[model samples]
Target: SAGLYDEARRGWLYPMDVNPAGQNAFKKDAWNKYRIECIGSSIRTWLNGIPCTNLVDNLVSSGFIALQVHSIGKNDTPGKQIRWRNIRIQTSNVKPSKADNIFVVNMIPNDLSAQEKKEGFSLLWDGKTTNGWIGAYKDTFPAKGWNIANGELSVDKAAGGESTNGGDIVTVKEYGPFELKFDFKLTEGANSGVKYFVTLSEGNKGSAIGMEYQILDDLRHPDAKLGKDGNRTLGSLYDLIASKKIANSTRPIGEWNRGFIRVNKNNKIEYFLNGIKVTEFTRGTPEFNALVAASKYKDWKGFGMAPKGHILLQDHGDRVSFRSIKIKEL
Candidate 1:
């Protein structure tokens, strides 16, 4: 049900969908054509030629299709129902329809759909291997505190110490002006981060130095209350800009949440949580410099201005799982 199309509103649930015409876009008391395209990890839907959903997921590679009437509320009539006519299913010679402007909700961990490949995205983490990662300030992936299994890479909980266990792990290669996407699942009261522009130049540190996409159980984590003006809360640009409060901005603890970061060639950066853009800022700007001056990293000159650097998965000594790590160099 992750990508189930909302016929009434004509949208998906991943990010909040906007329908300009709203429900008026639907034809009432009449038959309408519905088309669904399910190929590999790509799933798209259309209602009378209007695109509804474009999703990429591998959770259910194969499954039989079934239709059912939704349960009604107590105030509704008991006999109220839904009907299907001219029902058809195509399994042969299936091809995807023309592309639309809707966003794709990619959920297959460590993999990409054909469209994503055509768009120049590649897997950053191979899901089960550490071939492209190494411990921060070290030459190899940490021997302990990080676990890889069942298509998930996770850090173990250890006394709530920052980088005290296995420390942080970073990408072997550096990236510039790229788009990064990852899926994370956090335990209750857990903390972690997906960092970018991590130069690792600061010789002395607990976690590697970088701008962070803060991850925390905002309700339970003390760090959520520690930063100025909620800038350290989940989805924030750690200690810099606060992620905007909005609908579907985050998922519940233990549920998978999508984290997206895009850095433009002009130094503009955007952060997203669960497909919703939350924080945006430009590096090396006067406003950005002033914000940094007021934060803990103020003493570090040239902070977050690296032209290219490794991506980091922080070892904040909490159980947090990561998957579907991918990047597209822009």
Candidate 2:
């Protein structure tokens, strides 16, 4: 058993629970009851009778239940304790009534919820397969240099170079007006990006040309210092428009950060990090074309002119991972 904090910060769950443990919505150090109920495909859980997890899964129709206490370090409090009582069950097909106030966190990965599906959302990556991706410079998925495991798609670490080693990957399908959401994690000084409106016709070398949502450790990466006025910092439209100096809520390194990129039919593009709007620019506008004219991509014919293009995951030869990749067509 290792420390739980490291895994919990990355949204890992305990063996017996649908959601992460130690949430402590109830008063700390106070006695709290955890109620777990299963009704066919639906498994609901409560902390102190306050609903917390609502999961629908049939794969785990049965299993053993066990209590886990992660191993602690030598400097830890010697007598760290956990207490539980009233460990009883009713197999008579009964469940506690749902409370309307408490939020129910769905911990199941990549599966669309009823509400999400009704709202016209679909899983873009499906969390476990590379069925929708291909190398930006090639027609098939790369034979090597990328990894898909445990529901995460990641680029392997190599010599720090832009699309030089592993190359870049793109969605097989193109997008026009869409809303994309995903979770990303960064290694120290890692430089990667999520790009859209990508046309493989750009060139045979280097990263694909697109409007990039820069993913970076701005303070640690040298690119943060080289770009014009932080234009290449995280959340910016890489190398062209600087992300606004707004309040951004980013998790620490090794933890997951949510990314949101929305493009309306009008080409109003927005980039958000952890639900905070960090950058926005309308493509095809005079100001946009002007900025592109001065940026590094000016030489590429028809840059940012593609009406519809694929979404790309940059392989900058640095370790970066993406998960929960999803998109909603607008």
Compared with the true structure, what per-residue lDDT tens digits does model 1 show for residues 80-106?
A: 656779988999998878666655567
lDDT (Cα, 0-100) at 317 in candidate 1: 94
Which ranges of candidate 2 are over 4 A from the true structure?
1-108, 246-248
TM-score of each: 0.81, 0.69
Tens digit of per-residue lDDT, candidate 2, span 1-330: 111111444332222222224244456678877777776656666676555655444545766666768788989978879886778977786764543332122335666656456556678897887898889879788887799999889999999888887689899999988888778899999999999889777575688888899999887899998779999988889999888765425677787787778898988888877645678888889998999899998887778878889999999989999887878798
> Which number leads on TM-score?
1
Q: Provide backbone clash counts, one per model.
A: 0, 0
* Candidate 1 local Cα displacement, residue 326, angstroms: 0.2
Whole-model alpha-carbon lDDT for candidate 1: 0.83
Model 1 misses residue 205 by how many Å?
Answer: 1.9
